[model samples]
Target: MFPKHVRTHHRLHHGHKPEELDFLIRRESVSGGATSSQMQREFGRLNEEEKENLLKGVGLRPGIPSGAGLLLKANLALSWNKLRHLRRWLRNWNVSLDSESKDREKAKGMTSPLVAEQLPFTFTVKGPDGKLATEVRLASCVCLEDISSTVLQRLDLLEREGKLTWHGVIPSDEIWLKIGGDKGGGSTKAVFELCNVAHPNSIENTIVWNIFQAPDRRHNIETAYKINLSQINALCGTMWK
Candidate 1:
């Protein structure tokens, strides 16, 4: 005999047997499309031990369709396989892109020219006492050694005319050209050719060379001699301040 509550809940209150009650519940779960929440509520009405015993006895549980669960699991596995394939493809694409970029750079380097196009600079000669001796414009491309010799020749011409006099060695081997500014980096080994130097602030694109002698003259004159070139543009003139 079925319990009164069971028969009432199953809508078989007209004194149905236990087998009829089970059949009604099974039919409600399978054919009526009962949800997981509804099944849980119905299952909760049974005692804990009874619920366990029933779960063991009935392999085909109620609520969710077995085929639906299997289908969902298969879909998830397929999605994971697609993701792994996409990741591998992206990695291969990146490697190919990097290889192409390196090849392009190598080709460019091979085709580049070696000679400097223009050599324009402004020169400032300072005496041992840190006084500005003269300022001249150089519009030719000459090596650092040639530039030093030119500066010495100019200074000699000035001395002969009684414009300036030096008590020490007339063309001191210590004389050297400092490129850029007063900031000293002993010597510049790199020689640039046919290069364009652009200074954002000024309109005059001229390299500044500060020619001076080192304070200590004991070192080898050849090794101590250093020359650097800086790109400092001349200031532009404007009427409107």
Candidate 2:
């Protein structure tokens, strides 16, 4: 089942099963023709603050209304087979615990001006022939040492040697990532706690791990894919309020 409000709205709007709702939510589909305004009306009793947090958790902004749509959309997006798994892995990725040895302000003066944001996450792309083209991973912990010469040197070594091992990922059956920190294998954490939610076990593990990085961007093609129209309509069902 989805969150309480989401489940209520699903029944009121579509008379659908949980799996069907799950499918529709990921696709961002609307059913039974509920408009965004309708959703707002349905959730009208919620306190303004609670509503706002709920919306943000699901990726909705303030004054956008569409409470129903927002809730469904967030659930769907977060549970998305590939994107959610990737996001969870990145969030759980542990940043190095070691404090910065040097000051960032001073280092800024010495180092070359930001060449580009250090790659946010790494992914592994495999071609039809099954040869690995690139290995990309996201980190859970973000700290000063991440960009240090030591880590860079390691990355360089991996690039030259072909196949780098990145670490600090949350451990979930769906969320598989290298465990530990640069100094040593760090502690292992679970994916459910990091995301604060869980999905049915029957769901297939159909997630891909890699894609090409567009210059100066934080997300890849897999992350940018859109949900279907039905979901958008359902989510929009409460937009007007």
Candidate 3:
């Protein structure tokens, strides 16, 4: 049985209750990252299950994430956080890689030309495993009128590619869809980390590629994207090892 009864939704916002804080202190002991020997002593005070629950909450398993995987995920989470902060700078510099409809109306009010463009809309195809198979976009341009058809065809192509990608558009298993809306920068980064875990290797590269490969990136280009594709490609090769 799971040790802690706290539902994830509550824990996320409120953190463990006072009684539960002890669980965190205990779990940190057995795990290798603990900084102090005092933590090891503290673990003796808690029941075993409480210790397990705390570790699980932080995504630590005895061997599952692997030491390297945990470190990579931690670093990736940090990088993603940094990326979110750049949005203000990106907005100032005119980067419009995200959905632009909101900006269009604002621009219309000020009589500014719609600085963003409508082009072949590209988005990542996320899988149930929550990892990305391949970076794919609508095989052709998509506008509201033809979006349905383009989405269908694109999924079909993705399925044919087969080795990594999948389709049939199951909500639970597979699907063809565009990134719908911004759910705040922090939310987006959290989702990105889940996808990275789901997809693992070359996870960072795939994300960078998606942004770089987009048709209309006008402002706030991340300088990281300027590195050669071949160099980026090399990272993918080493993802799993």
Candidate 4:
């Protein structure tokens, strides 16, 4: 016999299974009908009586106030085959993680910026020529991961003769970077810890080493910078309390 939970949710038999049929029927109801080929197949397997029950809205309330419909959809969303989205999630997604308000004027008048206003800071990467390979900066936040990608790109490591072998990142103690004067890559912190930078302003300007400068650690490319942090700036008026 199938596990108790599995038996409660699904059944393989073609005979009338009220629990299983109700699940698929209710999915289509809140979802405005089957949206995909797989869904259409599962829906077609339902008995005529089940279809009739859905048409009569047997287990649902009318339109927007349909509390039962909301609960059913929420349950289905957690299933292996996600049936429908929670109504509030759809609303937030359309906001673009920015803002809603179709009226531009209302958005403009609001104090909150659509996306976080990223503070700009710069990094100087030295090329193979030992000169400025590229200048990298984020429109806002700065962290170890961000710097790694930027450093690799700015140094043109992709086009370089050597591939970045994943020997493993060096211990944070061996590789050094500063957010500001004495504020970066603490003596005890590791690269994993450095990745969680609290603020962008922490790494405004730092000199990244050329491979030649650290020949022994060249193969371990990810952690070769000797960065220094002078001032650590957190978001104004937006910091979490």
On TM-score, the candidate that comes out on top is: 4
lDDT values for all models: 0.37, 0.35, 0.36, 0.34
Which tens-of-lDDT digit does each residue in 1-241 have in candidate 4? 3233333334432465788676655554544543366566666888987764664564442243323333343334343123233434544332111122222344244222222223323445798889985443433322332334343342343226343222355443232223322223322122211221222222222322221122122222233333211112111122211
Candidate 2 structure quality by residue, lDDT tens digits, 1-241: 3333344445544877788767656333343334455566656978977775676678643332323322332346443344334434433432111112222333355332222222334445896899976555653321222122322343344347654322334332332222121121331111101121222121121111122233222343222212112322343232211
**Best of the two (2, 3) by TM-score:** 3
TM-score of 3: 0.17
140-212 per-residue lDDT for model 3 (tens digits): 2212222233334433443465523333333344332222212232211101111212242443312211222
Q: List the candidate 1 regions with Cα displacement exceeding 4 Å.
A: 1-145, 167-207, 210-241
Ranking by TM-score: 4, 3, 2, 1
Candidate 3's error at 33, in angstroms?
A: 32
Ten-residue region with minimum lDDT total, candidate 1: 232-241
* Model 2 CA deviation exceeding 4 Å by range: 1-32, 63-241
Rank ordering of all candidates by lDDT, starting from the highest:
1, 3, 2, 4
lDDT of prediction 3: 0.36
